[model samples]
Target: MRLAHGLDINHPVHKAMVELGKRLEEKSNGQLIVKLYPSGQLGAERECLELLQIGSLDITKVSAAVLENFVSDYKVLSIPYLFRDRQHSYDFYDSTIGKDLLHKGGDYRLMGLCYYDAGSRSFYTKTKAIGSPDDLEGLKIRVQKSHMAVAMVNQLGGAPTPISWGELYTALQQGVVDGAENNLPSFFTSKHYEVCKYYSFDEHTAVPDILLIGTERWSRLNERERQWLQEAADESAIIQRELWRKAEEEALKTIKKAGVKVNYPDKHPFSEKTRAIMNMFKGDSIAQKLIRNIKSMN
Candidate 1:
């Protein structure tokens, strides 16, 4: 099987994928092989997903934010303040709701294998520290292409600018966008900390990365092969979560050493500011139900 993703080889997610390949090979006794192309060697997340739809790619990892484009149900995962904390997020992923969201992409030719910890996303800025929603006023925030992300930023009083991850560094350098939101590991690994000197832990969202296989490719596998692959994926997710926790800790320490100012702002105001984001989906019964279900988990 061929797997591709846009993350750098040093990323915890990439390391998890490596573990997945190793485990898969061991379980299948060399009958199954996984060829990985990291660092966007094959294409970006969306392109890789498209490849999966056509069976050109066997598997890929994409943010739930991106997956929402194909599977609208995933938009629930992008809602700000959706999960109470890391444990809440994990509980959601392991719950029936999360599992249902994972398989929702089957109609679109994608079969989600498991979730990987991408961590909670927070704001990192260049010129000013975002201590509250008022601080975000008049600022342009770079967001993912997902509508939910744009809506959250807008609701929080910042102008949301959707920019591809590959172009974000230059966008920040050239002042194309004032700041961006991402997890600590990404802020450190992407070197965005160099430009965005302020790291605020508002922890607005805990969107996870979804590991997906092409439905066509999945159907081609024998039952035993499918079992081996699923088991490998499940185990890799556990490994990735531990790796992500350590990475977040190290990223905070390293960014501080690099002179980035980190702050843990009271999250209530940020959460209150973005609460309107939920009502934006009131017309969508499915999304509203998801919101209620997720909140009930907390």
Candidate 2:
């Protein structure tokens, strides 16, 4: 069977994908083989999703935040303060809400295999320390091309500039964009912190990395093969979460050593500012249901 994998080479998510591939090969005893195309060799998340739709690629990893652009239920992950902490995040994923989300992609031809850890997102800037919403005023901040992300940034008073991750370093360096928000490993791995000197620990959204397979391709797999792949994905997720936690700590240490002034701002202020933005979604029936469900979880 010909299987194709795609992801950004340096992304921790890809590391998890590699682990998944390894497990699949081991479990199948050489009957199953997967060829990985990391570093956007196949394309970025959106492009990869498109490829999956046409059955051109077998599997890929995508940010839950990006997946929200296509799957509305996914926006639940974008909600700030939704999880009490890491444990809460994991519990929610293991709950009914998680099960529903995994199947939510079926309509779009993307089958969610499992979820991987993507550390909490925080602010990193070129010159200014983002202590509160006030500090974000007037700054041109780069965010993923997600409406929710853009709304979150706008609520903080900064001009939200949607930019792709690949071009962010140049955007920051050339003043095409001023700063960006992401997790520590991403900030370090993407080398965005090199241009953005201030690393703020606001810990905004804690979206997970979702492992997905093209539904078209998955349908062709025999029942036993499908079961084996599902089990392998679950094992990979467990391993990746552990690695992600370690990577987060190491990333923080590495960035600080590189002279980045890391600050834990009064997150209350940041949270408060975004409340208005969140309220707008209060009327969204689907979003409201998800918000209620997550808050009810723990």
> What lDDT does the true structure give each of the candidates?
0.93, 0.83
Cα deviation in Å at residue 21, candidate 2? 1.0
Tens-digit per-residue lDDT, 181-286, candidate 2: 9899888888877898899999988988888899999999999899889988899888888888888888889988999999998778877778776676766897
Instruction: For each of the candidates, give the backbone clash count.
Output: 0, 1
Q: After superposition, how far is residue 99 of candidate 2 from its true place, in Å?
A: 1.9
Give the runs in model 1 whose Cα sits over 4 Å from its true position.
Answer: none
What local lDDT does model 2 show for residue 17?
74
TM-score of each: 0.98, 0.95
- Model 2 residue 177 CA deviation in Å: 0.8
Q: Any runs in candidate 2 off by more than 4 Å, and if so which?
A: 1-10
Candidate 2, residue 179: lDDT: 89
Error of 1 at 195 (Å): 1.3
Candidate 1 Cα RMSD after full superposition onto the native fold (Å): 1.0
Return the top candidate by TM-score.
Answer: 1
